[model samples]
Target: MSDLTRKTAAELSELMASKQASSVEVTQAHLDRIAAVDGSVKAFLHVDTEGALAQAAAVDAKRAAGEELGPLAGVPLALKDVLTQEGVPTTAGSKILEGWKPPYDSTVVKRLKAAGIVILGKTNMDEFAMGSSTENSAYGTTHNPWDLTRIPGGSGGGSSAAISAWEAPLAIGTDTGGSIRQPGAFTGTVGVKPTYGGTSRYGLIALASSLDTPGPCARTTLDAALLHEAIAGWDPMDSTSINQDVPPVVAAARNGDVSGLRIGVVKELGGDGYQPGVEARFHEAVELLTKLGAEVVEVSCPHFEYALPAYYLILPSEASSNLAKFDAMRYGLRVGDDGTNSAETVTGLSREAGFGDEVKRRIILGTHALSSGYYDAYYGQAQKVRTLIARDFIKAYEQVDVLVSPATPTTAFAIGDRINDPIAMYKNDLCTIPSNLAGNAAASFPCGLADEDGLPVGFHVMAPVMRDDLLYTVGAALESALAEKWGGVLMSKAPELVVNR
Candidate 1:
C-alpha cells in the first residue's frame, strides 16, 4: 500500500494544506490501493476513478488560488451505496435498484462535496440494509480485512471494510441497527452513529426510516470526528433534521480526557452470550477508564434485553413502507412487461426477480405485522418496547455522563457461519440496537483484539441525545491509552492483504 493511502484523513488533509502533496496524488494513491486489494476485500460495489480525480483536482486548484477551505478539504472518502450521489449508480445492494443512477445528491453527499471532500464511489451493503452480514448483498459479501474468511458486520460492512483495508481513509455508513458499529468492532475501525436527525437523512435509501442514521467510519477517532463535522447539521429538506448547533465533536476528540466524568457500564449487555476475550478486553477498558480518574459504575437498563425483538418488528414495519416505492413502475428493474400482462403482474414479477432473499423475508414479516388485525399486537407492541428502551436510556443518562459496552458479543465470525441461521445473525446487534431504537448518539472504537480469534474487539460508548461529543471523548481517550500499550492502533495488528499483482 502507498504510505499516502495508509495515512488518516486528518494526516492527508494536513499534507495537502502544507502543499507537501496535492489532492490528486492522495486520491490516486487510494484508487491504486483499491485496485490492488479490493478483489480480495470485496469492500466496494463501485469505484469512480475519473470522478474522484476530477474532484481532487478541483480542490487542488482552489488551494492554488489561496481560497479558504474546510478542514477535510482534499481528503478522499468512500460512500455507502445507501446514500445518493447524483448520477452515480446507487443500488442499496439489491438487484431491484441495480444500475439506477440518482437524479440528485443525498443530503450527506451534498455536505461532503461542499466540504471539498473527494467521493471515491459507493461501497457494498446488505440488500436494503436488512441483514447483519454483507452476504445478503446482491452483489457480494465484504470480507473482513483482518481475516478474509471472516464476515465484516453489515449492512454497512463495505464502508467499514474500505477504511480497514486502507482503500479509503474515511467512509460514510448508515446504522439502522448495528450496521456501522458492529462492523467497526469486527474490522477495528471507528464508526459513529450520530443521534438520529443530527445528521440529515434526505436521500438515504431507507431500510427502517426511524432507525437509519448516517454516520462516519475511519481509522482513527479524530478522523471520524472531522468527517462527522463535515457531514452533520440541520437540513431544511429533512423534516426530522435537528435544528441545533452540531455538537462540538471535533473539540471533544481533541480533548480526550475522562477525568471526573461519570461512566456507566451497562448491566444488561454483557456476560453469557459474549465471548470471553471480548469481555476481558471490555473490563480492561473500563478499568483503564477508572485509572484515568473517571468514576465507573454499573447501571441497569432492563429493557435493553427486549430491544432486539422490538427492533426486528419496528425495522421491518418501517422497511415494508419505505421499500414500497420500488414497485417496478419507478426507475429500477422492471420485469414481465409483456403487453398482455397487467400492471400488478409486472410489479410482482419485478419485485420477485429483483429483491434478494433477506429483503423478501423482512418485507413479508413487516407486511404481516402491519396487517389490520396484527398491527396492534405486533407493530404497536414493538413501538411500546421502543419507547421503554428510550426511557431506559433516559434513566441511565441521568446517573452517568455516558454508557459503555462491548461493541459486539464476539470478534468477526467466519463468513457464512450464521447466514443460514437468521436468528443467530440478528443476535450480532444485541449490544447496539438499543441506541438506534432510542435515537441516541453512539460509537465503536477499537479497544483491543480478541485473544482467541486474534481479531479486533470494539469498545462501545453511548451518550445522551445531542451529546455526540461525549462519544468522541470516550473513544479518543480509549484509543489514546490503548495505542500506548499496543504500540499503535489496533488496525496495525491486522494481517496484511496480499496485493493482487
Candidate 2:
C-alpha cells in the first residue's frame, strides 16, 4: 500500500470512499509524518492535529451514516501562513502578528472545509510572501528536502517543503511573482498558480493584491488539480473572481495525452544566466514534449524582458497600500507602553518591531515609489508595463497552445548564499515571475534531476488565462514520462530523512 502520508489526494479519496481507510486513519498518518519529518524541514509554523482529527472524525461519522461525501473528503491539507485560519494564529511568517488568531477563515479555507478537507494548520513563508527564499521568514528558514542546508523556494517554501518531505500530501499556497511554481521546482513537487481570479482571494492576507494568487501545492499534478477544483470559482465577497464555469481539471489529468498539443518555448528564457544542468534538463523536457507529438515551436514575447523590473515596482507599491491596514489598534501584535503612550506612538513602535528587514525595506521602497512626485514615474509606468506584458502573452498564445520555460534558473542554493545580495536572490525567479505579472495559469513539475547536485529541476508549463486545465494535461503527461525515464519519482531520490523529533 502507498504510504498514507504520501499518497495523492485522489488516491486517499478513493480509499476513503471504498471503506478501506477511515478519514481519521488518513488524517492521523499525515499528522504522524509531520511529527516525524517536518521538524527537521521546519515546514509548518504550527500543526493543529486536534482540530484535524476532529474534522476527520466528523467525515468518518458521515460515511458511517451513508451520507454522500465531497469529492476530496477527509484530505488533510495545510494553509500557507499568509492565509487566515479561524482560531489559528495566522502569522504571515513575521513577528508582528505572531499570536493573532483570525476570527474567520479565508474563502479558500472555507471552501476546502465545505469539501471536507481537514486543515492541518498554517505553514511558514517569507514574511508577507515578499522574498524568493524562506530565509526571510521571521520564524526561521525552511530547508530543502533534497539537502537540508539548501533552501526550498519561497514564499510558499513551507508548503512546498511540507509536501516534498512527506509531511502532508497537499497544501494551499499563495503566489506573487514565482512563489508557487519556483518552490515546486526547487522541492520537486507540483505547484500551480491559477489564472488571476481563477481562485478567490477573500480572507487571504493581502500581498500585491493584483498579483497575489492562492492555489494548491501537492505531490502530483492530478492532486494539485483536485485541490484547485475544490476551492476555485466565484465567491460573493471577491469582486475580481470570474463567474465562469470551473474547468474539469481532474478529468483533464486522467485524460492526459498530449498528442495534438502545441508547446511554445519562450525564446526569452532558459538560455544564458540559467545553470547548465537546468538548461540541459529543460531541453530534454522539450524533447519529451516533442516525442508526445506536440508541435514544438519557439515564440517570442518582446516585453517579457521588462517583467522583472515592472514586477518589483508594482508589487511593492500595492503591498505598501495593502500592509497599511496592520496598525496596532486594528489587528495583530501591539507594542509600546500601554498607559503612557499615545496610539500613534504605539502604532509606530508596533510596526517598527513587527516587520522584518525585507518587509521594512519594501515598505520604504514602496512608500517612495508611491510618494507624490514618483507615483507617475514608478507605479504608473509599471502598470503600463504590466499592460504591455499582458499583451505580449495574448499575442504569443494565438500561435501556441501553451508556453514552456525553465521553472527556475537553477536548483536550490545554500541556505544563506544569496540572502545578502538582494539582486542575486531576485534573479532566481527570472524565468518564473512573468506568469504572475501576466495573470495566467502556470505549473511546475520535475523535468529531470540536475547532475550538478542531483537535485530535481523543473520545467514550467503555462497556458493562457483560464486555460489551467491545459497545465494539468501537460503536467500529467510530463510527470508520467519523466518519472518513467528517471526510474522513479524525484522524491524517491530524496535522502532518507532522520527526524529529530
Best by lDDT: 1
Question: For model 1, what is the alpha-carbon lDDT of residue 237?
Answer: 89
RMSD of each: 0.9, 1.2
Q: What is the lDDT of residue 479 in candidate 1?
A: 90
What TM-score fits each model? 0.99, 0.98
| Cα RMSD of predicted structure 2 | 1.2
Model 2: per-residue Cα lDDT over 111-223, one tens digit each? 98899999888898999998988999999999898899999999999999998888888889988888999999999889899989989889988999888889999988889
lDDT score at residue 354, model 1, on the 0-100 scale: 96
lDDT of 1 by residue, 1-501 (tens): 249987988889888999999999999999999999999999999999999999999999999999999999999999999999998999999999989999999999999999999999899999988877799999989999999999999989999999999999999999999889999999999999999999988999988878889999999999999999999999998999999999999999999999999999999999999999999999999999999889999999999999999998999999989889988996899999989999899999999999988889999999999999999999999999998999999999889999999999988899989999999999999999999999999999999978898889999999999999999999989899999988988888888999987
Candidate 2 local Cα displacement, residue 389, angstroms: 0.7
